[model samples]
Target: MAPKEKDDKPIKINKWEGAAVKNALDDAVKEVLTKKFNYVENFALMDGRLVICGIAVGVAMFALVWDYLYPFPQSRPILIFSVTTYFIMMGILTLYTTYKEKGIFAVCIQKDSSKKENVWEASSYLPKYDDKYNLILALIDGKTRQRRETSIKKSVANYIDVNGSVVNELVEAEVTKMHNSLLSERKEK
Candidate 1:
């Protein structure tokens, strides 16, 4: 016999707990491994550049100031300003790349009802299973590269179904793997 049908009512998804977050990440992963190499590519380049440039600029700024016989402390505003600006510039570059690679990232990060509604609506069609797999995979992918969680959420949101249990299970299996990975990662850190 078939499993009892779950009501069409959208489950109250507490993103902070249980399999919801993991499943979401899994679903995006399915897409990432399949349709979104560009997203990953852009992220890798953007992040790698951000980290490298951030450190380089920070070092150069300190070196430039250190060489100066200025009557200011090392933590003076000017020195701080220079370094801060470099970080800001890096942040903007990251944002631009992120926005270009993954449209409307702001929606997923917001805490408002509208954001939740939109995320759910956008993901309404992608049932528990497939979405679970794709999302879990994507989140894991992002974590490996130091990606923001919301980016994974946005990617997961893009590929959703209303109710596909079997696919959700496949996705769930992957999600479980991601969860295990995450726990181990935390332990390692």
Candidate 2:
């Protein structure tokens, strides 16, 4: 008997199924991000930095005006101190914000609505950490909104790891549950 050739054809899925899969993958990624990595999408740090900058600017302006009006040696020192304080605060804010932003790990799975392609485009932004596997995964959708979720188990396993191992068991379970629920919903409709 002749050896059977493996089929290399891609599976054809409708737009509805593709959307469902994309949604499930997105949800799974969000779960992994929040549960395993403990990443929350909050602007508290940025807001705090802005508030501090405002205070520094106000102090510097007050010192400058005081020195201009009083013209005293003591007031000059206060002006210098306020100006120096503002610069130092700005430098610290820049450095800390850059460090924190670079440390964030992110992943995105988007469907190209412009094109009629069925493939869901996936991309990941992993932080450069000392450990290769210690990464935080965040899934962003087409709208560019940062959705806090878990990692994609099978759909994005290759993107996360080269060994094809499941990223997280919890993520895998969640993905399976979502997929099953989606399928059941489709059957009921």
2-96: candidate 2 lDDT, tens digit per residue: 76653222222232333333333344455544444444434455566687788788988898789888887768788788888888888877786
How well does model 1 score by local distance difference test?
0.41
lDDT of 1 by residue, 1-189 (tens): 877665333333444333665444434443433332222222343465567577758766775766485646754766666667777777766776565434221112112323221111012122454433223122322233343222123333332343422234344344445545644654566
Cα error, residue 168 of model 2, in Å, equals 29
* Full-model lDDT for every candidate: 0.41, 0.46
**Model 2, clash count?**
11
Residue 66, model 2: Cα distance from true site in angstroms: 1.3
* Poorly placed runs, candidate 1 (over 4 Å): 1-43, 46-84, 87-91, 103-168, 172-189
Tell me each candidate's TM-score: 0.30, 0.34
How much is 79 displaced in model 2, in angstroms?
1.5
